[model samples]
Target: MRPVVFPHWFHRIRFRCKVCHAELGFKMRAGANQIKMTDIIDGRFCGACHDGETAWSVENCDLCHSGKAGLPPGIFGGHETLGPGRW
Candidate 1:
């Protein structure tokens, strides 16, 4: 699987640790959870928050799959610049 770009700072702005750790059952350590895409599409793990009504829909693959090309601006507070230098 490709690397997932989970912007913690973004989630932190809205949620606390318990929200994901205690409530959602996400392991504190990364890669501890053997998350399967089917689980998500079937409404589990990330699906708990990304079921469209909650956050961005899972069907929107790029939302989770990153580095393919183009990420939304303001994702990193818009600090990251794109392309060549200014003229």
Candidate 2:
């Protein structure tokens, strides 16, 4: 399975890890998060908050699963690339 890079900062402010990681029992490893489109459509994973409340809806697959390399655009908003030298 492909890796899904969630917007950590976006979720950090809205909810703690316990809400989805612990409560939903998602693994820390990528490909082990066990999320599915069907589940999300049924209000799981991102669907929990993205149910037209906190962020974009689950129907917008490209919004979260754009299949691009690294974090999606605007995540840092034209800032320098983040790496070992940076934070």
Candidate 3:
């Protein structure tokens, strides 16, 4: 199975776990999301949010699946570095 690096922070804002997990019936573990190109083309998984609302579309593969170990550095823009006090 291919790796699926979902944009965690992006979805957290507008959706709850149930939306993708229970509602969409996705697995909790990594590589268990059961995503497929066919599904996306049919408006599922990445295609669901990547339809140009929350972020870039599935056509922009690098936006989510960069084929890297993790999210590229600075992608979150110091948001992870900040703490409750910083806000």
TM agreement with the true structure for every prediction:
0.69, 0.58, 0.57
In angstroms, how far off is 58's CA in candidate 3?
2.0
Candidates 2 and 3 compared: the better one by lDDT is 2
- Sort the predicted structures by TM-score, highest score first: 1, 2, 3
For model 1, the run of ten residues with the poorest summed lDDT:
74-83
lDDT of 1: 0.67
Model 1 Cα shift for residue 59 (angstroms) = 1.5
Clashing pairs in 2: none
Tens digit of lDDT per residue, candidate 2, span 1-87?
223556554554566658877876666444455567787778777677678777678657666765456643333221233322456
True-structure Cα RMSD, model 2: 6.5
Q: In candidate 3, what are the lDDT values of residues 1-87, reduced to their tens digit?
A: 223555455665667768977776766654555566788767787667667776577677666555455533223322243423465
Q: Which candidate is the best by TM-score?
A: 1
For model 2, state the Cα shift of residue 87 in Å. Answer: 7.7
